[model samples]
Target: MNKNLIRRTAIVAAAGAASLVLAACGSSDDTSAGQSTPSAVSSAPAAQGQHNAADVAFAKGMIPHHRQAVEMADLAPTRAESAEAKKLADEIKKAQDPEIQTLSGWLTSWGEQVPAEGAMDHSAHGMAGMMTAEEMDKLKDSSGKAFDTAFMEMMIRHHEGAVAMAKTEKADGAFPDAQTMADAIIISQTAEITRMNSLLGKN
Candidate 1:
C-alpha cells in the first residue's frame, strides 16, 4: 500500500511539471509576437514624419521661389517669340504647381507655416536668383524675341539659385522626402540650365 501511494505522488508531480513547461512556452511566444507587431507599426511613421529646421527652411523658401518661377512661366505663353521658350515655360508651370501643393501639405502636417500668397517679395529675404520688382516690370513691358531672350537669361540665373538651395537642403536636411526632392531639383534644373544656355547660343 505504501508503494502504491508513492507511485501516485510521483505521477502527479510529473504532470504538474509538464504543465508548467507548456505554459512557459506559450507565454514566450505571446511576448515575442506582441513585441514584433508594435515595432513594425511604429518604425514606418517615424521615418515618414522625420524633419528638421533645414527641411522647414527648404520648404518655405522654395515655395516662393517656385511661385515666382511659375509666374514667369505664365508670362511666356503670351509674350515669348520662340517656340522652345513657350514649351519650356509650359513644362515649368506643370512641374512646379504640383510641387507647391506637396510642399504646402508637408508644412501643414509638420505644424509649420506655408508661405503666404503675397510673399512674392523675395527681395526682403535676399533670396538668391530672385527678381526685383523693377526686373519683373521690365519683363512685363517686353514682348516677342526680346521677351524670349530676357526670359531665358533670367531663368538661367533663377535656376542656378534653386540648384544652390537644393544642394544646401540635401546636405543639411533630415527629412528623406525633402532630400529626394532636392536631388530631383538639382538634376532637373541643371539639365534645364544647359538647355537654356544652348538655346541662347551660350553653350
Candidate 2:
C-alpha cells in the first residue's frame, strides 16, 4: 500500500511539471505575438510622419524642377529631329508626372504649400542649371537637329542640377519616403545624363 501511494504521488508531480512547461511555452508565444503587431503598426506612422526642414525643402524645390523638365519634354515631340529624342522626352514625362502628384501629396500632408505651376519662372535664380527666359524662348523657336542638340544639352544640365538636389536630400532629409524619392532621382537622372552625353557624342 505504501509503495502504491508513492508511485501515484510521483505521477501527479510529473503531470504538474509538464503542465507548467506547456503553460510557459504558451505564454512566451503570446508575448511575442503581441509585441510584433504593435511594433509594426507604430513603425509605419513613424516613417510617414518623420519629416524635417530638409525634407520639406527637397519636396518643394523638386516640384518646380520636375515641372520645368516636363515642360521641356513637352516641346520635344513637335520640335525634335531624332526619334531617340522624342522617345527620351516621352519617358521623362511618364516618370515625372506621377512623381509630381506624389510630391504634392506629401506637401499637403505636411501642411506645406505646394508650389504654383509657374513658380519655376520666379524661382529660377535660386535653382541650379535652370534655363533663363531667353534660353527657353530659344528652345521654343528651334526645330530639327538644332532642337535635338539644344534639348540634350539643356536636359543634361537640368538633370545634373536635379541629381545634386537629390544627393542633398539623401544626406539630410528625415522623411523616409522623401529620402527614397531622392534616391530614385539620383539614379534615374544620372543615368539619363549619361545617355544624353552618349547621344551627343560627348561620351
> Which candidate has the highest TM-score of all?
2
Per-residue alpha-carbon lDDT of candidate 1 for residues 156-197, written as tens digits (9 for 90 to 100): 999998999999999999898999999999999999999999
lDDT of each: 0.90, 0.89
- Total clashes in model 1, counting residue pairs 3 or more apart in sequence or in different chains: 0
Q: Model 2: per-residue lDDT, tens digit, 87-175? A: 99999999999999999999999999999888664555669778777888999999999999999999999999999999999999999
Score every model by TM-score.
0.78, 0.79
Off by over 4 Å in 1: 1-43, 121-124
Which residue pairs come into collision in candidate 2? none
